[model samples]
Target: MKKITGIFLSMLFAVTLAACGAKAPAGEDVKEETKTEDVNDEKMTEEKKDDKTSAKTDLNVFAAASMTESLEELKAVFEEENPDLNLVFNFDSSGTLKTQIAEGADCDVFISAAKKQMDELDPNSDTKDSDITIDPDTRFDLLENEVTLAVKEDSRKDIRSFDDIKTDKVETIALGNADVPVGQYSESLLKNMGVWD
Candidate 1:
C-alpha cells in the first residue's frame, strides 16, 4: 500500500510539469502576433496619407531667366503647404528652357517672360528623355514685365532714366539680344520713344 501511494503521487507531479511547459509556447506566440499586427497598421496609415496628397497636387515648373529670384521665393511657399507633392523649377533664359522643354524635359509648368517662346512651344518642340513632353494646348499667360535700363555701378553720368539714353554719350549700350524678351521689350520701348533712330 505504501509503494502504490508513492507511485500515484509521482504520476501527478509529471503531468503538472508537462502542462506548464506546453502553456509557455502559446503565450509567446500571442506576443509576437501582436507586434506584427501593430507594424502592419502603421504602414497602412502612411501609405493612405501619401496616396491622398499625390492625387491632389504636383507641379514641374520651367521659368524664364530674369524671374529666377522671384520663382524660388514662390517655390518655398508652395512646397510648404504641399508636403506630399513636389515643385521642381527649371530656371534659365526663356529661350533655353523652351528649347529644353520642347526636346522633352519632364515638366508640368512653363513660365515664360515673353509670349513668343511659349507660342513657339505651341508647336511644343520641347521634349524630355526622348519620350515625355508637354502639349501646346496647356499654354497660357502667367504674367508680364517691364524693361529697365541699368548702368555699371562705378560709372557716374546721372543717367537716371530713358531720356538720358538719347544723348550721344549713350551711343553704345550693352543690352540683351533681340530674340530675348527683355531685348524685345527694350527695342520696342526705344522705337516708340524715338531712341533707336
Candidate 2:
C-alpha cells in the first residue's frame, strides 16, 4: 500500500510540475540550464512548499457508497504515505454526494458512480443550477467500473445472466436508488433489454 501510494504521489507531483512548465532540460537548453537551474529549483521548491503549506491540509473526498471499501484502503495508505496530507471521505450515493457538494459542502474531490451527478456540478452545464459551480478544468474522468448482476452464493433461485432478470424465475431485483449512478445504469440497461418497462 505504501509503495503504491508513494508511486501515485510521485506521479501526481510530477504531473503537477509538468503542467506548471517544469519540464526536463533538453539539447542546447541543458548547457545554459545547469547554472540557473539550481537557483530556479530552489526557488520553485520553496514556492511549492509555501503553496502546500498555505493550501488546505484537509481534502474532502465525496464518493459513491460502492467505492467505500476501496477508498478506505486508499485513504489508509495515502494518509500513511503522506503524513502532511489529510483525506476525509464522505461515501454515499453519487446523487447524494452531488447534492451535498452543490449545496455548498466543501469537497476537494468528487468521485461519482454516474456521469449525471457530475454533470449537474459542471459550471457550464445547462442543467446546473445557479448555485452549482464546478471548475470545468478540474473535472476529468478518472475511472470506469463495470456493473455486474449478481446473486447470493447460497441462493436457491437460478437467477444468473442479464436475460434471466426479465423472466418470472427471478423473484426480486435489488437496485440502487433511482437517482444513484448504479441505479441509473441498471435502469438504462434493463430498459434497453426490454426488462424495465
Candidate 3:
C-alpha cells in the first residue's frame, strides 16, 4: 500500500512539474513586441482570466472515519504539491458515507474501510441493485485490516480470546452498531462463535 501511495504521489508530482515547466508559444514574444501597450493591457486581462480558470477546485473525498488521522496527514502534503486542488474531506463510517453518496451527495473520491459498502454502490456488483455508477477501473484495495479484541491493563477479567468472552468471567461487552463495517465484522465473528444469540 505504501509503495502504491508513493508511486501515485510521484506521478502527481511529475504531472505538476510538467505543467509548471510548460513554455509559451514561440511567436508570442514577437507579437508582444509589435504592440507593447496593447499587448500589456491584453496580458493583464489574460492573466486575470487565467487566475479565474486556475483557482483551486474543491475535490470532495468521503472516507471511513478510521482513516481520519492518516488522510489528514496526506492532505497537507497533497494540497502543498497540488495547489490547484482543494481537498474537502467527509470522515464518517463507511455505511454513513455510502448512504450519503446514495442520497446524491457530491463525492469525487470514496475510500471505504470495507468492500461491502463499495460493492453496494457498484451497479455491476451482484450483491446489490442500485443506480449508482462508479468506475470499476479506478477501484483498488488500498489496505487490509484485522479485527482485534483488547482489554484494560489493570482489568481483572479472565478474557484472553473470543471464547473467553462467553464465560462468566465477562459481564458486559462493547461492540459497534450494525450500521458500521466493524460492527458487522463483530457480529459475524460472534455468530460464528455460537455466542451471539
TM-score of each: 0.59, 0.66, 0.70
Candidate 2 ranges with C-alpha deviation above 4 Å: 1-56
lDDT of 2 by residue, 1-197 (tens): 00001111211232233223455556757756674677678778877876664442677788889889999988878977876677878998888888787776777788888778877777677776536566677788888967798898988878778988878878888997788777788888989998786
Give all candidates' CA lDDT scores. Answer: 0.65, 0.73, 0.75
- Each prediction's number of clashing residue pairs: 13, 0, 0
Residue-wise C-alpha lDDT for candidate 1, range 50-132, written one tens digit per residue: 55644544466778878888877877787777664556567888878877766656556778888777666554444222232
Best by lDDT: 3
Which scores better on TM-score, 1 or 3?
A: 3
Relative to the unseen true structure, what is the C-alpha lDDT of residue 55 in candidate 2, on a scale of 0 to 100? Answer: 49
Q: Order the numbered candidates by lDDT, best leading.
A: 3, 2, 1
Candidate 3 lDDT over 1-197, as tens digits, reads 00011011111111111112234479686665556657567767776656644566778888999999999999989988987677889999999998887776777788998999988777668875446545667789999867789877888876798889888988888898898988999999999999998
Q: How many steric overlaps does candidate 2 have?
A: 0
Candidate 3 C-alpha RMSD relative to the actual structure:
11.7
lDDT of 1: 0.65
